[model samples]
Target: MDRITPRQALRMVVIAATALCFLMPLYWLTISALRPEADIFRFLNPFGPWTLIPNQLTADNIVGLWSGSFSRAIVNSIVVALVTVIAGLMVCASAAFALAVIEFPGRGVVFTTMIVSFLIPFDAIAVPLYSIMRGFNLQNSYAGLVLPGIGNGLAVFLLRQFFQGIPKELREAAMVDGMGWFRIFWSIYLPLSRPALVSAALIMFIFQWQAYLWPLLIAPSNDMKVAAVALAQFSSAYNVSFGLIFAGAAFLSLIPMLIFVFFQQYFTSSVAATGSKE
Candidate 1:
C-alpha cells in the first residue's frame, strides 16, 4: 500500500539498467546460436528492420557439435568435475576436521602454514608441477588432471571455519558413546554441515569445469580435452564456424547455469550458514 519515494525509484532504475548490461551479451549469444549465418552478420540492424524469420532457425550446429568430439568432451568434463568435487571435499573435510577439532603441539602453526599457502599463485608453480607430472608419466592422463586440484587450501580453510563453529559438547557426547573420529565425522559433523559442503562443492565444480589453461597444458590430445578446451579449438583460425562456436559456447554455458538453477537453494543456505557462524 506504500508509495515509492524518488530515491527508491532511482535505485530501481539503476538496478534494472545493471541487469540489462549483464544480460545483453548472454541474449546475443543465444540469438546468434539460433540464427542462421546470414542473420549473425546483420546483427547490427535495429529491432524494427531486423526481421527474424522462424524458418531460418536451425539446430544443425547443435546436431553437428553433438556428433563430433564435443560429445566426448562433455562426458570428460563431467567426469573430471565430479571427480574433483568428491576428492576435494573428502580431503578438505578431513583436513578441516583435524585442524578444527583435534589439538596437537604444532596445530596452530600448521593451520597458519596452510592458510599462507593459499596466497601462492598456482601459475607461478606450473613449470615445477608439469615436471612432476612428467616424472610420474601422468601427462595427458585423467588422474593427472584430477590429482592436482584435490587439495585446495581455500576449501580446507572455509570448511575448517565452519567445522570450528560446531559445538564441542556434541562431539564430546559422541566420543563418550564410543563413536570414533570417522563415525563422528560422517554421522554428525558432515550431516550438520551440508550447506557449507554443498556451497564448497558447487564452487569447486565450476572452477574445475571451466578450467582452460591447466587442462590445455596437461591434456592436449582430443581424447583428453574438456569442453572449455574444445571450445578454444572450435574457435581457432583454421576452423572458424561461427554458428558451431556459438552453439558449443552456449552448450558449455548451460551446464553451469543448470547447476546453479537446480542447486541454488542449497548454495544460498550454505552461504547463510557460513555468515551465521561468523
Candidate 2:
C-alpha cells in the first residue's frame, strides 16, 4: 500500500474522531454497568477517573437485571420485534411490488395515501386502535403487540422506491412466460431485492424494539410488558437506582447491536443502492 498522504491522514483523523464520539457513550454505559453503585456516583460528572476503568468491577447489577422480571420482558421484546420484522416485510414488500410493477387506476392514490399516513404518528390513532383491538379481544396478546406495527408506511415507501429501481423487462419477460404476478414477485423480484428487504426489516426491527407507548397502552400487564416498558418500571417515587437501570439498558442494547452486526453487509448494500434506480 502507498504511504498515507497529509490529506488522507487528516481525513483519517476526522473519521476516528466521529467514531469515538459515538463509541464514548457506549463505553461509559458498559463501564457504569460493570461498576458498583458507590463507585458510579463518586463524581458529579459521570466521566471521572472512578468510572473510566471501573477498578471495583462487579457483576451484581447484570446478574440482578438478567435474573428478574426484566428477563421475561427481554424475551417478550424479542418475540415482538421478530414478529414485527417478519410481518412488516411480507406486507410492505407485497404492497411495494404491486405499486412498483402492477398497473392500476387508483395505484397513485393508494401510494399517496400511504405516504400521508407516515405523517400521522401512532399516538393519533392509539385510542381508536385500542378500541378495535379490544373489540377483537386481542389486548395483552402477541397478536395485539404485532398487528399495530405491520406494514409500516415508511417501510412500504422505501421498499417501493427500491422496487422501482428494477428493470421493467424482467417483469415483462416473466409475464410473457405466463407466470402470474405472485410468481414473478416471488422468483424474479424477491430474490433480487434482498438488500431492500433487509433494509426494511432492520428499520421495522428497530422501530418495534424501541416501542414503548403502544405496548404500554395495549399490553400493560407484567406478563405482556416489553423491555422498553419494563425499563420504566424500574423507576419509582422512592427509588432511582442508576446501577440496575443502566445494566438493564446496557443488556437491552446488546440485541440490536448483535442484529446490526449480523446485517451489516446487507445494510451497507441497501444504503448504497437507495437512489440508484435503473
Candidate 3:
C-alpha cells in the first residue's frame, strides 16, 4: 500500500468536515428529540455535551405525538405520497418511454416544452391551480393534493435520457421477433428500465412525503393535514412543547430515512445511470 500523501490527508479532512457540517443538524435533532425539554433548553450550546450526550432520555414526547395528531397526519402523508409515487411513475415513465424510444413529429419541440415547464415554479401557478381545483370542488380532497403536482417534468427528462441510451439493437431484435410497439415496450424496455423507474419513484415518494405548501393550500382541513403541515401546527399550538415537536419530527424523518436506506442501492445506481451519457 502506498503511503498517505499530505495532499490526500488534507482532502480527506476537508471531506470529513463537510460531511459533519451536513450531519450536524440531524445529530442535533436526534439529540434534542431524545433528551428532556429542560436539558434541551437549559443547555444552549448546540454542539456541546447536551447534544452529544443527553443526560435525560425520554420517550413520552414521542408517544404523545403518536397518540395525538401525528398518527393521522402520517397516515394522510402516506396516502398522498404513495398515490403520487404510483401515478407519477406511470405518467412520467410512460411519457419518458414515448419521448425516448418512439419517434414522432414535433418530438423535439415537445421535449423542449416539457423540460421548460419545470422553470414555471408551482408558487407562480398556485392561484390558478387553486381556482381550477376549486372549480372542480377538489379542495381538501386527495385528488386535489395528488393531481396538480403529478406532472413531473424532471422525472420524464431523467427517465427519457436513460431510455434513449438503450441500444437500438434491442428494438430491432424485438421487431424481428414480431413484437409490436406496446408489446416491445412492455416486455423489454420496461423490464430493463427498472433502475431509472425506481429512482424516479423514490424521488417522487420523497417529494410528496415532504410536500408542505401545496398540501397545506389545497388540503388544509384537519382531516387532510400531512406530516409537514402537522409539524407547523405543533409549533403554532398555544402550548408549544419543543420536546414533543422534536420527537415527532425525528419519528416523521424515519420513513424517508428507512426508504433511502432500504433502496439506497437502487436510488444511487439509477441516479448515476440516468445522468450518464451514452
Question: Who wins the lDDT comparison?
Answer: 2
Considering summed lDDT, which 10 consecutive residues are worst modelled in model 3? Answer: 44-53
Task: Give the distance in Å from residue 149's predicted Cα in candidate 3 to where it truly belongs.
Answer: 2.7
For candidate 3, give the lDDT of residue 25: 79
lDDT of every predicted structure (CA atoms): 0.83, 0.87, 0.84
Ranked by TM-score, top first: 2, 1, 3
- Per-prediction TM-score to the true structure, in the order listed: 0.88, 0.89, 0.88
Regions of candidate 3 where Cα sits further than 4 Å from its true position: 1-9, 45-48, 267-278
List, residue by residue over 201-263, the lDDT tens digit for candidate 3: 877786787677888789889888888998988899999989888987887777887887888
For candidate 1, report its TM-score.
0.88
Tens-digit lDDT track of model 1 for 1-278: 29999999999999999998997777677767787865676745666444433336788878887998889988888899999999999998999999999887899898888888778877677778888998999988899889877888888888999999999999999999999999999999999888778877876887788688888888888898888888888777496888888888888788888988888887677678799999
Instruction: Score candidate 1 by lDDT.
Output: 0.83
What would the per-residue lDDT of candidate 2 be over residues 84-183, giving only the tens digit for each residue? 8988899999999999989999998999999998888887798898999999999899999998789699999999999899999988888899999999
